[model samples]
Each structure stands twice: as structure tokens, then as C-alpha cells.
Target: MLIDHFPVLGLRVRTPRLELRYPAPDELAALADLAVEGIHDPDTMPFGNPWTELPPDQLARRVVQRHWKTLSELRPDSWALNLAVFLDGVPVGVQEVEADDFAIQRQVHSESWLGLRHQGQGIGTEMRAAMLHLAFAGLGADEAVSVGYVHNHASLAVSRKLGYAENGIGRGVSRGKLALEQRFRLSREAWQEHRSVEATIEGLEPCLSLLGAGEE
Candidate 1:
């Protein structure tokens, strides 16, 4: 089976209201359509790269193309699990957890987005909590980090709700202007204290080696 050969394809992190998993081709198509529909407001750029500013067609194409690149380029030392975000079995967005030298550093970084239509229902916090569970509980991570532009209130709110402490400040250019970023960090201890959502991980053991997390 494909899952046996590519165990990452079988990874899943599920919460009561959300599921995070590798996107099947059909699900990936749905995500692309969702991206074309929209994510953030036009006047503000949440990401440093300003990917959401691309034309509709280009944005859709980039969604699919980026997923392909992440899949093909995965390695034990550096990898990204760009799981599609599904709510009630419907594709809504993406929840990504990535790491560099994970086994040595035991840390992961996460980012996510929900369709504009899907925002404001707490799905963002729930989906992220699910990933946090996968990182700290299933994968034995030490710390998890996230960064949000100071103006991106929704992302910052989610981080605050999840018990992330301010790590530092970072400055960058976004949309050709200065962007102030609030870097946040959540240690495993903090996660355990702040975690309110229940989540479970399935099919992670087989992909441990690929994530540089296998028993040594």
C-alpha cells in the first residue's frame, strides 16, 4: 500500500473538531480552491513573504506546487509536515509543523491558515493545539516556536490562547514596508499546562525515522 511505502502519508493528528493530515490529491485540490477563495484581507499581509498577495490563479497554483516541493524534498534532518486542515471532514486550510535537526534540537515550528470564511470559529486555535499535541506528546519535542506579525491579531491570539510566551522581536520587510514580528515559544511544560484541546496522533511511529525521531 502507498501508506506502507510512505508512512508520512498516513500520519494524522485529530482533535474533537479538526483533523490534520497529509492531503490526498483530491483534498489538495480542495485546498487550492479554498486558497483562491481567500485567506486574509487585501490591505494587510500576515506573512513575511506576502504569498497571499499573488493573483488568484497564481496563489492556487502555488498552494499545490509548494506541497509537492515539501513532499519531494523531505529529509530526516529537515522536514515539513504540511497537513491539510479539515473540519468536520471538509478541507478548510493547512496546518504545518516543521523542524530542523529535530532529533538533536527536539524542537518544531508551526504555522497555519484557515479560509477567510472559516475564521473566527476558534478552528485556528483548535487545529494548532492538535499539532502541538503531535509535537510534544507523539514526537517528544522540547519546544515549539511560532512568529506572527504584530498586526496579525488572530494569529497572535491563537498563540496566546495556547500558552506561548513572547520569545523575542524580529523585524522584516513585508509588502515593501517594515514588518514587526512577535516571536513566540511554547515549551513542552508550558504546553502541558495550557493545553485545553484533546488530540491524538495516528500512524506516527513508522515515520519516526523520516522525522529524525526514531529510537537511537
Candidate 2:
């Protein structure tokens, strides 16, 4: 099985309403379809790269290619785990956690988006909480950080609900205009206190070193 050669592919995180895992090729295709369906308002670009603005064909290709690129380039020192978010066996979106020099800094950053039909339904918070569990409880991370444009209330609210503190503020360009960004940080201590959603990790032990979780 592929998991024998790349154990990270076996990793899974589950919450009451969601399951997050590395997407198989077909699942990745489903995700591409979901992305084409729509992730956000056409007028607003939540991601710094403005990937959502691409045409349907390009967007689908980008989704598949980006996942392939990340998997090909993963290493202990730097990696991004873009877990496909599944709800009731259907692909809904993505919840990603990534780090640079995680063995030393022990910190991870996360970002996510949901299908337009899935937004405002609280699945975002639950899925993010699952990733937090995988990072802190499963991977021994010291802190987790996230950033959102100041106007992105859904993202900001999820961080606040999870007990993240305002870490800093900055300015960046969004869709060609200057935008304010809000950074939030959640330490392990805070995570322990604020954790509410029940979550579990499976197949993480074998993938630890691949994620730089065993370097130190």
C-alpha cells in the first residue's frame, strides 16, 4: 500500500462532525470539483495568492497541482500538510497546517477554507480544532498561529473561539488593495484550557519523523 512507503498518507484527524486526511487521487479530484463550485464570495479573495480568482479550469488544475507539489517537496525542516476536510464521507474543503524548522521552534501555522455551502455553519471551528489537537496533543507542538485579513470575520471568530490571543497586526495587499491583517497565536497552555471539541488522531506515530516531530 502507498502508506507503507509514505506513512504520512495514513495520518487522520477526526472530530465529531469531520474527518481530515491526505486526499487520495480521486478524493483530490473531488476537492478540485468542490473548489470549482466556490469557496468564497467572488468579490472577496481571502487568500494572499488570490487563487480563488482563477478560471474554473485553472482553479481545478491549481488545486490538484498544489497538493502534488506539497507532497513532493515535504521534508522534516519544512512542510505543509493540506488535509482534505471531509464531512460524512464527502469532500467539503481543506484545513492545512504547516511549519518551518518545527523541531526547533515547535510552532505551526494553520489556514483553511470551506465550500460556500459549508460556510457559516460552524464546521470551520470544529475542523480547525481537530488540527489543533493533531498539532498539540499528537505532535507536541508548543504553539499554533493563524492570520486573517481584518475584514475576514469568520476566520477571526474561529481563532477567538479557540482562545487565541492577538499576537500582532500588519498590512498587506489583498486583491491589489492594501488590507490590514490580524495575527493570532495559541500556546499549548491556552489550548489546553480552551479545547472544547472532542478530537482524535490516528496513524500519527508512524509519520512523526516525517513531520519533524522527532528531531529534538
Candidate 3:
């Protein structure tokens, strides 16, 4: 019944070990609490923006606010889809894919973070690969780009494993200090080279037009 009114909720992306889709209200709260629990080492700043520096309550509030903002501001040409990632039916992290003028550029950008407990496992790679499947295979994207802090080796490794080439370095301010960000580029050809994870996407056809993928 709800899918009839909001078709985006109908979309689903599934990997061998995970399921990713728009988070319901309860799931959004779960994702927020997971963020508060931990995402990375407190001594190091892995993200360029430093959103995690806030106190737990503020950080949790930011996470919740961001999801709602993205949903409210969505446009066909420019939008962000923040999906709650569930591994074996347990909430583990958030996977975000977004674009600016997607119809014209056919480009997408991605960012994600798994809870501290879920890290050091292959879950991060699988979650990213699953989103890449939605971007490249399901939506027909030409390129997908990601940026990670230079010292964020784990993120870099995941991008490399997914066949992304090193684009260059991007400097930015993080926690009032200059941060080295590594840019990664994944062309369709490069993406085709890596397919270790098997993924399936469902309920995409009805929403294709809204995503500028043309009518079925």
C-alpha cells in the first residue's frame, strides 16, 4: 500500500550477505544509535567533514537530521539516497549514493561507514560493491567516484578492490586542519573488471523515470 504512494521504498538491493534500501523510521533510529556507538578510531579523523567529532547526542541527531533532509530535498536530477545497510538482517551501517545533474553527467558519488563492530570484516567491501551494482548495473552510470582521507587505508583498499583507479589528491579542512583526501575514479570499464560479489536489484523499473532512466 505505501509502495504505491512512495515507490522508492519498493526499491531493494541485495548481496549475498546484505540488504540495502531506504530506512524506515525505526531503522533510521537504529542506524543513528549504531553511529553513536562507534564508526572509527577517536584519535583519527577518517572523514573530511569531521561530522563524528560532536558529542554522542549531537552526532546522533545529525545522522537523523541528514537522512530526513536528503529525503525532503530529493529531485530527479540531483538527489541523495541514504540506505540503511543490514547484514544477515541486523543493522550494521549506512550506504549513501548521490549525484548532481545525474541525467546529464551520468556520474555518481558514494560514501559509507560501518559500525565499529562491523568493521575489519569484509562487510564494508560487500556493502560498497552492492551500491556499485545499483549505480553501474541497475542505473547505467558511466562513472562512480569516491574520496577518502589519505590515511584511511581501509576505504582506499575497498575502492581499489572494486577496480577504482587513483584519480589524485584533494586537500580539504578536517577538524581545523588540512586533510589529504585520496580521490578514486571508477569508470564503467573498470567496474566491469571487478565482479566478485553477486548482487540482485529489485523494484527499480517503476522508479526509473524519476531517476532519469527513462520510462519502461
| TM-scores for all predictions | 0.97, 0.97, 0.95
Best by lDDT: 2
**What's the number of clashes in each of the models?**
0, 0, 0
When 1 and 2 are scored with lDDT, the better candidate is 2
TM-score of 2: 0.97
Tell me the lDDT of candidate 1: 0.91
Q: Clashes in model 1: which pairs?
A: none
lDDT digits (tens) for residues 1-216 of candidate 2: 878878889899999999999888899999998999999887777888999888999999999998888888889999999899999999899998999999999999998889999888899999999999999999999999999999888899999999999999989899899999999999999999999999989999888898899855
lDDT of 1 at 153: 93
Residue 159 Cα positional deviation in candidate 1, in Å, after optimal superposition: 0.6
Model 1 misplaced stretches (Cα beyond 4 Å): none
Give the whole-model CA lDDT for all candidates, comma-separated: 0.91, 0.92, 0.88
Clash pairs detected, candidate 3: none
